[model samples]
Target: MKTIGRRMRFYRTIGAKLKGGEMAAILNISQGSYSDLEHDHAKPSSDTLIRYCTETDINIFWLLTGEGKMARPIGEVEKEKEENSEISIIWQNGMVVGNHQVDNDHKYLISLINTIQAAVNCGLGKEVILNYIAQLLSYTEVHFKREEEIQRSIKFNSLDEHKESHKRLLDQLISLRNEVGSAEPGEHQKAILEILFNDLTEWLFRHMLDEDLKMTEYFNLEKNHRVEDNSEE
Candidate 1:
């Protein structure tokens, strides 16, 4: 119960910093219940677990196992002991769609994103930083391609718009990388990192809720259809 309480408190502390009311809304839980969860007065249900992971970028490993840091392990504490510098991305479960391939791809993309953040936080040199960015860009393209193919196969109506959004994100990332590449080290690098963190955090959250959620709904419908057909047969 204390483990649950610690996890909930961890969530609540970050949630308060990031806007408690908004996070509660995203989790679809009452603020009172959310507070209770943080205080160890209540436990999260299955659905709450799914939503928290998806919405808050909380580490499921740390949440469940209590083996690692409560927040993302971006850098060693001795290196940049800044009180506020912690990686705050949560991994949400993709809720077993019939498409194993697509789900796996999504997980890989998430891992890449987290890895890049970790690399940045570790204070790597410019070349190493650039390499990480390139890796992120490359994998993101592949991930988007696979996701689009799945949408096309199912004739998802918003495929065009979704793909367009993906293109825009890719373009933005490329431009940002180029900007960072030319900047002198030190303050400029820090500024570039701030921009990267803000943009990436915003984009991931919105994309999951807006674009990826649509795909999740489509797969759910397809799954239900197949189940109904099998029942009929």
Candidate 2:
């Protein structure tokens, strides 16, 4: 369908076989908001679009433009990852938030996620994979603190909302970590990896692209004003 609403409803009812509430939970939105999305009453944010794509393994380009296949084939996903072994989640220019330290932290976080993917693909032991998850979670806490500090320095208006988002991400990571730790190695390996790739990685991706990118506009304006002041001196 061309309209995102129609497509959303189609995916919810047919593609993913999920009810509205279930899909809403997956996107971290309320039932009312999800209904509005399906009825074309409201446009989705970048965060919503990213969550729908990543969580459902739906083709993002198709989700927005309806140009590509609805979902990438499993073989294609595996092949693509094999070809790009260094990174599982591709970083794009849009993900940059115009802050050097924060951007570097994002890059490191992506690398940590990729490291976990590699471990899973290599059939590493559960303990080894758990260690990587711990590293990602630890570094994520550091990254969130750094991000909040930078925003505070600038008095970013959306700081509170952003911090709440960080808390949600951390909670999801903790839950995933516990779930993976509890699963049987051979039986639940696939399920564990799927959650890592879809839920955890994409949630972080959505945060950087949608939440942190908000900083770019404010940061640039702040920089420009500072430059003008320097010129006046």
Candidate 3:
């Protein structure tokens, strides 16, 4: 097994109890990638690592160095759990965009943000946060293409405008990433996180509720018509 994957197996078998495909789903990665990750052939993206650590409460120290316990100390773990739980966006079913794939993708994206927040709350470090942001932006581009495909399938009226919006948001994130990448790592990165986080909260969370939900309505109506016609036949 690869180093991280071997450590992940230890982390899993030692303390955590999760199903096989759960990590892959949470990371929005292919099952093959997860499998390869275990064998040490494939490396995890920043988003995946952050998601894994956040969900399992695995010690970043243990994950990297493999010289410590997989889980945090009980006292610190409890305190951190309480702290992290206090400031999370509680995901709910109402956010569903009526399309299974789109809804699931949205769920994963929101979870990524939360994972970063949890890592930060646990005081992981600016390095982890910076890496997660870069990974998050890359994954967002992949998701945008999926969303655009759905838009084309449904003939979404605002497809052109929506594509533009996606491009603009992506450009903003790329700009932020470049800005942060050039800066020295330290206290200043927190300000960058704040700006990026706020933008993400607006774009990912708020956009889901405001814009994606409306798109859901349109898509659902189209689906219902198809269903009704099928039933008649």
Candidate 4:
């Protein structure tokens, strides 16, 4: 992949299961710097990458090239499992936006991303990735519509702004999907898949935390305002 940090974070979180602080300590960097690295805000040094792989038994080649399996197996059993395993995001409690329907949609979207990632991990080729991306694009359109409806029902002041954000994300996805459709097989397709998955993961995760979580804030404010009105009455 072009961004080493994304692969670093994937190995750190999925393979090693290390938290940011824990991973930073291993890499001998500040937690803030490590966070920046994972988010692709900062570039990691070669020393840092080497140290991380050395400590975790991660395959440096795979981490750097996005080829082969992730972990360099220390045992036969581990080797078998690692061989079959794919890089995927684990859903966390903190990702929940406190809106049931929206949260469900978010979970499903994450699952879809994970499925596409697995297909890529197994070297399933272009057609499979294209089909999965098509399905994801269809569901995402539905999810955005549902989210906007909820916002409207609640009289959310920023509904229009939220709709605009959805439009932008969808447009970006469509662009990437089209690129995948036209890409040649083998290395070219592999490169596009890497970019597509990394970009999609980053955008969707940020949307949930930075944008979708605003819905929870709106709900809390509304509840407190109603409480104040009752007290005044």
Each candidate's number of clashing pairs is 3, 0, 2, 0
* Local lDDT at 22 for model 2: 60
Instruction: Estimate TM-scores for all models.
Output: 0.60, 0.68, 0.57, 0.61
Candidate 2 Cα misplacement greater than 4 A, ranges = 1-41, 45-87
RMSD of candidate 3 to the truth, in angstroms, is 17.1
Best by TM-score: 2
lDDT (Cα) of model 3: 0.62
Query: Which residue pairs of candidate 3 clash?
Result: 2-39, 2-40
lDDT of each: 0.61, 0.69, 0.62, 0.69
Off by over 4 Å in 4: 1-85, 221-233
* Candidate 3 off by > 4 Å: 1-86, 182-186, 194-196
lDDT of 2 by residue, 1-233 (tens): 11222223333323224455765775566888677445642444443444454434445554445576765454565566556544466555545678899999988997888788888878788899899999999999999999999999999999999999999989989998998888886767667765565556556755675478779988899889999999999
Per-residue alpha-carbon lDDT of candidate 3 for residues 105-125, written as tens digits (9 for 90 to 100): 887887787776676666666
Model 1, span 1-233: residue lDDT tens: 12222233343333323444544665566887566445542444333444454333444345445556544333433233255344545454422334778667656655666666776787767777778789878987888898889899999899999999899888888887797798888898877875665456545544554356567678878889999999999
TM-score (C-alpha) between model 4 and the true structure: 0.61
Candidate 4 at residue 205, lDDT?
Answer: 56
> Deviation in angstroms for 228 in model 1?
1.7
Answer with 1 or 4, whichever has the higher lDDT: 4
* Residue 224, candidate 1: C-alpha displacement in angstroms: 0.9
